[model samples]
Target: MVEKRATQRHRVFKGGTITFENSGIACTVRNMSEGGAAIDLDTTITLPQSFTLLIERDNFVRSCRTVWRSDRRIGLAFVQ
Candidate 1:
């Protein structure tokens, strides 16, 4: 298999929240890198074109955009 991402990702299992405006949903951080992350949710959802991802334990917050999605997972690219 070929790796297509610009940066390597590391596997993770951390709680996360996807928030836009006043709404938010819980997610699990599956894997992450300096450029992006892959998150898993409880169910399929419709998210905004862009939103903020908060990983409280890591004190990490970043603006991101959806890059791809599956049944209950989403790929996100950090906006800089």
Candidate 2:
């Protein structure tokens, strides 16, 4: 298979939250890179066009946009 990512992604299993306005949902990070990440969300609630991805344990928060989705998982690209 051909690799299409601009950067390598490392597998991860950390708890995080997806927040938009005053709402938040829990999710788990599946894999991550400098550019983006794959996260497993508990629910398929409609998220905003752009929202904050917070991994407090890692002290990480970035503005992100959804790239794709399948079932309860979604791919996110960090906005610089």
Candidate 3:
């Protein structure tokens, strides 16, 4: 597959949260880069198209939009 990401991703396994409109869901940071991330969510339930991803361990919080999804994994692009 062609490399389409703006930044190279680093593998990770940090716990995180996706929050939107008073709703929050648990997730795991599977990988990350300057522009985006891949996360594994605990549920297959639908999520808002836009949300905030908070990874406390990394002291990171980003506004994200759904890029893709498969099973419980979601690909997100950081919103600028």
Candidate 4:
């Protein structure tokens, strides 16, 4: 399949936590790009059509929005 993303992805997997409106959960970032990310969650978590993702990396913190979701994963994109 052809990929149609403008940003290049980093293969580094990072450990992180996800706080949803309904619940707070621990998740792992599968990969990341300048534009978005794919997250792996322990269990199925229903994500709103749009939500905020607070990502903390050492001294840096970033926020993104949920664009898509599945049974055990979610896709987030950077908010302009």
Which candidate tops lDDT? 1
Worst 10 residues of 2 by lDDT: 40-49
lDDT string, candidate 2, 3-69, tens digits: 8889999999999999999988999999999999999988788888999999999899999999999
Model 1 local distance difference test score: 0.96
lDDT of 3 by residue, 1-80 (tens): 99988889999999999999997888999999999999997779788878899998878999999999999999999999
> Best to worst by lDDT, what's the order?
1, 2, 3, 4
CA lDDT of each prediction against the hidden true structure: 0.96, 0.94, 0.92, 0.72
Q: Best candidate per TM-score, number?
A: 1
Please, what are the lDDT tens digits per residue for candidate 1 over residues 1-80? 99899999999999999999898999999999999999999988889999999999999999999999988999999999
**Per-candidate TM vs. native?**
0.96, 0.94, 0.93, 0.74
> Candidate 4: misplaced stretches above 4 Å?
55-57
Each candidate's root-mean-square deviation in Å? 0.7, 1.0, 1.0, 2.4
The predicted structure with the larger TM-score, 1 or 2, is: 1
**TM-score of the candidate numbered 4?**
0.74
Ranking by TM-score: 1, 2, 3, 4
**Which ten contiguous residues of candidate 1 have the minimum total lDDT?**
41-50
Candidate 2: Cα lDDT at 74: 95
Expressed as tens digits, the lDDT of each residue in 1-80 for candidate 4 is 89877887787577777665766567788878889888888988666555555557744335667767787878778666
